[model samples]
Target: MQTINLLLAGFQSAFELAAFITVVVGLLVGVIAGALPGISFVNAMAMALPFTYAMGATQAMLFLGGIYVGGVFGGSISAIMINVPGTPASLPSTWDGYAMTRKGQVKRALTIAVTASATGGLVSALMLTFLSAPFASFAMRFSQPEFFAATVLGLVSVIAIAKDKPIITLISLLIGMAIGTVGVDPLYGQARFSFGIPEVESGIRFVVVMIGLFAIGEVVDLVASNRDLRPKKTDGKPERVRLRDILAVKGAILRGTGIGCMIGVIPGAGATPGAVIAYGVEKQINPRGAEFGTGVEAGLAAPEAAKNATTGAAMVPLLTLGIPGSAATAIMLAAMMLQGVNPGPLLFIMDPSMVYTIFAAMIIANVLMIGAGFGVAQMFSTLMRTPPAILAAFIVVLSLIGAYGVRNNIFDVYVCLVFGVLGWAMKRVGFPSAPLVLGVILGPLAERYFLTAVANSRQDYSVFFTRPISATILFIAFVFVLWSLWPTLKSRIGRQPA
Candidate 1:
């Protein structure tokens, strides 16, 4: 009871006038950055970090945390309206969100998005506030063997629920694992895939690869699609959406939140896998989920909840183990470090107030998003009213600016244009771009673990399976891989079902 009382009191303490003002400004900045294609949450935080130098740690945390939460929810607005996801996390929202737009229920879809996002974000924040210490304690007790086991469990579990083609998913996972090997081996200094290039020795920059696969690849893929093949003019009217329909997607909301929270616990795995797994689970559990491509609010609700829930859950890694989850969290972690705030177990003991403040700010941002998001989306909706010529030029310039802002480098700009074309072409051939992004993000982690396990066993192949946790995780991975290959193996023997 005392713990409960203290937590509620802590929430109240967040009402300082200064914190309130920071929340307001953060909301506005986050709204705009989130709606702008290619200007992801990470970039927004990085861009704003310079200004935060003047503020105290608590004050700066309020602004950064507020914007982080708001930006995530903000992506849903443009995703639903434009058929273009403002952030990678918004991809699943586009499945039904844009369909709802075509059904002329844009406003209603937006409302459902807001409601689900708020619910998920709020719940996750509360969970993080009260449960973080315990979770952090648990994470601290994990040894390398346990860590390896956990990592293996995640990959195997994720593969089980990935896209329709498990075989394809494994192939993608392996490709990622292989890419992870490109850098210097953690156990020994020898490089495997550097090809003797100095630039490659530091290894492929994870951020650069993400920028390429997600940001660049998406643009290329979208542009390659023949404009004529786009969905017809069934865009929904603002008023067509009903609260009843939003309420009906409750199952998706609940399922998505659970999945998002679970996945977010993994350091380096955040909303991307959460969204994909949520979408996949919704397909199995909800009747409407199977009808997703045909257009359904349930589909939108599931991904919206999953993606936004991850916003708060991703903080768990950063706060607990000083490890970042998603790329956005990576940038946030860096920003905090720049301000001289080290995030670790000691941070919890030494700066409880500052930690509580961030927790409070997270909740406040979700609340602010409800009102700020509506206005931002409505104003930006005027984009639909703009002529194609004007919009095209605007998109081009905006994309260029976004690419260059990553490092003010022209090389990235070329990468974006090239990937944009590639992405467009890939979609034409029925290939999904997400696997490519996942391949890039997970590539490194998989490689490090594999090499570490091998070295610990003195290059023995069985060392990875020696520990109880590691063995369990490896067994699961083996099962998952074989399960994915089952049908293919059967088909080769002429035993496939019709």
Candidate 2:
């Protein structure tokens, strides 16, 4: 009953003019960004982060929440229309969705994709609303040790998701953690990697690192490759979607949503894995599995549902434990911190109104995404017609400005530029940047929690293992790592000569 009342109050707050408009604007920005090849919604979020400073904490979350929800679905627009995935999570869409496009069923594919995405997101948002309070209650028992363990679990889960190339991912993650340690030590306040540079002592802001890595690198690549962004016209007449079309794939949508919700809450397994796994699972279980890649509606629906479903599920750990699961959520975390708001169990207790308002905004965003998706799909060609050079220049300027805006410091701009070049190089080499960004965001939190736990326990490291919750979480991390690597191990062993 209390939860019901709180949610009602939340809806009331979310319905306010400013919050409603913010969500609409953010949804538009996200859809446009996600539909454009090479310019992802994550990049759009990073660039938009600077603009959030003027918003209230609630409004900022509403804005970003709208973007997060809308962007996840927007990627499929391009994938279906042009055989190009605007975001990595949209990769599966290019297979079945583009197949549908080639068959002149592009409209049918889009209807299924958007409908499934909105439904999955709606279910996930409802889950976030009901499940978060209970999770927050559970999290109230967590101390520093448990928090540290949870952070570790988040870090290792990144490896699990990128299991195909764990070594490279780990190296990238470690490099990010090393970068995270460049400023004053969290506990001791002593600087280690400053190298006598005063600005360096304050540490590199993750926001700057994010913009440098995601935005600048992507822009440079688009410019250098000179890839044409326009969507090719399809030959088929647009098919009208009926309610029967949606009913036919209901099972796939539900299964994908379930899988996405489960994977999303794991802290590091994000939408990309969720989508891929859904596609894989749907292929195995659906009766038409053998026909998956040839414009099967179920195939397109499942991954689309899974990817958008992840948006709300990924927020579970962030709101309950303050652990960010992906780059997008990490940026949201940065926004919260910048607004002087700390997320976690106490956030629920201290600010239920704000928490529930975010929940309400998420629900509203998912509902509104249908309209936003169609609007952008219509304008996609016009958006693509903009010159790549002009777009690249605009992104570079925005990124540098975002970096400089961190502390209003020019040195941060230089740092951003340097990392931008590094990011471009890393991209060229096929190194994963997501894990590195996750490491930077989570590393400092882990350090802080670990040091505090040890210090509170008289410097005894065993305190982590002594506690049941912490130990259990660590054990889960261990098992998760083994589970993630087992396939590779098995394949390698099978390949060995007798």
Candidate 2, 77-124: lDDT as tens digits: 877875556676786787688778766676688889989999989998
Candidate 1: deviation at residue 321, Å? 4.9
Q: Report, for all candidates in order, the number of backbone clashes.
A: 17, 0
Alpha-carbon lDDT of model 2: 0.80
Model 1 TM-score on a 0 to 1 scale: 0.81
> Lowest lDDT 10-mer window, candidate 2?
228-237
Q: lDDT for each of the candidates?
A: 0.69, 0.80
Best by TM-score, which number? 1
Model 1 alpha-carbon miss at residue 363, Å = 1.6
State every prediction's TM-score relative to the real structure: 0.81, 0.65
Error of 1 at 118 (Å): 1.7
TM-score, prediction 2: 0.65
Give the lDDT of residue 416 in candidate 2.
Answer: 78
